[model samples]
Target: MLVIFPACSVFRFQVSQGKIIDPPWRPSIAGMIRRTKATVVPVYFEGMNTLLFGILGILKPRLRMFLLPREIIHQTGKTFKLKIEQPISYENLFEQKLQSDVEIINYLRQRTYHLAHRI
Candidate 1:
C-alpha cells in the first residue's frame, strides 16, 4: 500500500499481509515443521522485532543492496557468517545511534501507553 505525503513525495507507507500460496508439491506436516524449525520463534515476538529493526537501522544500505522479497534473507544471513565489505561497527557510532534509538523507543512506548490509558 502507498500513502501520498503532502510534505515529502518520497515518503510512503507500504504494508504486506501474510499469505499462504499453493506449492507444486506437498510435504508431510512433520516435515514442514522440521523445515521451518530454524526460523520459527515459539515465544517473544517483540524481542524478535526489536532485534530485526535494530539490525535494519544499522545496515540499511547493505540491506537494500542485497534485497530479498521477504525478511527471510536477513534471518538466513544470521545463521551463517556474512563477510560484508562495510560491516557495521558496534564500537563507536553504535553507542550514539543506539542512545537515540532507545530514546525514540521509550518515547513511543510512553505515548502508546498514555494513549491506551487516557482518562
Candidate 2:
C-alpha cells in the first residue's frame, strides 16, 4: 500500500520555497493504478519545507544528513499536518475513456493542492 508520486510530479526548487507544485505525472502511475486495481487515496503532506535542505545536500554532495534534517527542524514549526482523503476506486473513476492521463492526474493534483492549502 505504498503510494508514490513519481519524481517528475514534484519540483526540487519549489520545496525550498515552501510551495507545492502541480504534479506532471504522465500515464505511468495512472496506468499502474488501473492495472493493480488499487484505490487512489490522495495523501497531502502539508507544512513541510525540508526539501530545500535536501537540495542543499544535493548541491554540497556532503554533510547530507546534517543539512537535510537540521533544515527540516529549523524551518518547520511545532505543528505540521497530513491530510488523507477518501479512497477513490480506479474502476469507478475510469469506467469510461473520456479522460486522458493528464486530466486524471491533474484532478488528483488539484485535490492534494487544495488539501495542502487548508492550513
Clashes of 2: 0
RMSD of every prediction: 20.4, 5.0
> Would you estimate the TM-scores of all the predictions?
0.18, 0.61
Clashes of each: 0, 0
Candidate 2 segments whose C-alpha is farther than 4 A from its true place: 8-11, 14-23, 51-79, 95-98
lDDT of 1 by residue, 47-102 (tens): 12234443453456355223333544445645432221222123432333434434
Error of 1 at 116 (Å): 1.8
Model 1 vs. true fold: TM: 0.18
Q: Top model by lDDT, which number?
A: 2
Q: Which 10 residues in a row give candidate 2 its minimum summed lDDT?
A: 6-15
lDDT of 1: 0.30
Candidate 2: what lDDT?
0.63
